[model samples]
Target: YLKKIGRRGKIDIWLVDGAKIRRDLEKDFTNFAEYYYFPIIPKYEFWIDRESVPNERRFFIDHLLAEWRLMDGGMSYQRAKEIANQKELSERKKAGDLEKVINQKSEFSPEKVHRRLLDKTKDEIDIWLVDGRLVRSAFDIGFTEGGHDLVYQYVPKNEVWIDDDVFAKERPYVLLHELYERSLMKSGLTYLRAHRKASRLEWRARHSEQILDEFFLKFLIKKGKI
Candidate 1:
């Protein structure tokens, strides 16, 4: 649930209980420390996950504000996010607590999954846990915690990948997001549309565990595995 903390200039700041969010969503590395959406409030509302330490909170806030402004100025979200990430990276480096990890993984190497498969049903799609950091380093640097075949490189034709970095409690939410996004794409939704809807579902899942149960149930029903 979101609690209004205060106003930041013209934007409303809300605090999210990130642990509860993780527990409710059943995901590990969903990795959204802060985010903002337009028209959800008067102009924009900024949300920060309470899981962030005090020293890290301001950096996330700075990133959100920068991202919001860039998007407001007609910049693409991808470009804006890249710039914001760079900004945050620079800030963290300045704080002297940032250590860039060197990825030694190979692109074509057979990576092991944390588990065999999320569900083994009649459906052809297979979901597996993967080293998301390695994937990002060797395959696509833009790779996040969750990804699937349609919009990503290196993924097989009918597979969903969950980052092994995600917490055991939160893996389910990330799986839900990847599965929903893939389903929407297969149903002919554009990647952008499908991604937006999936992102919203992920957000809702963060707030309510019931949503997770209902979504998984629907998924099982669709797979005829119920």
Candidate 2:
């Protein structure tokens, strides 16, 4: 009964339910096609009851839009690099390292230190630590908050922040540093590499949400009411 229809990760299957045939047919012919396909027709009137749609459907659609906005031109690679460089310089100034800080202003202006960090990549552990530090710093800045009162409001241009209260209260930076360092020491680079790979996977997932939505729409259409 469970015949394999495709390769793994892209498999499809058909199910039959004699007892619930009426319910299944109603869904296939009316509910699914009405909500998904009727909207496609130029002059077709489609009425969807808000309470009828599944929660997962709404979640998927909303998440797709959110990811699309995040990866839009507003947060381009050049913008990210510029923000990172400015924040690094500001931190140096705050730490009274102004005298030692470099004056050049190109992509590789702080060449020595940047090169040092890049060279310290003895293993994946080092890269994970760097990524953890970046995440911890963002958390300290109130970027994790749910409202408009977050650090993002005041520091609108940059996507990172340094909230004094949050930093003092939770000390997430120290915790993350300790946790990652301990994980690195105990498990070697395996866990660290997994973390890095997971981060990349997350980015890809966010970027591909729109494609997934289109796929779902196509599925609904192929089932009939297009």
Q: What TM-score against the true fold does each predicted structure earn?
A: 0.53, 0.20
Candidate 1 accuracy as TM-score: 0.53
lDDT string, candidate 1, 1-226, tens digits:
4677667788887776555644454334233433334332345577565532233556667777788889888888889888987776666557543122332552254243334465632366777766654454445545656788888856877888876655556667777788889889989999999988987898788788789888877766232221
> Scored by Cα lDDT, where does model 1 land?
0.63
In candidate 1, list every pair of residues with a backbone clash: 26-170, 26-171, 27-170, 27-171, 28-166, 28-167, 28-170, 29-166
**Count of clashing residue pairs in every prediction:** 8, 0
Query: In candidate 2, what residue range of length 10 has the lowest lDDT sum?
Result: 113-122
Across residues 138-157, which tens digit of lDDT does each residue of candidate 2 receive?
A: 22221221111111233222
Q: Which pairs, if any, clash in model 2?
A: none
What lDDT does candidate 2 reach at residue 74? Answer: 58
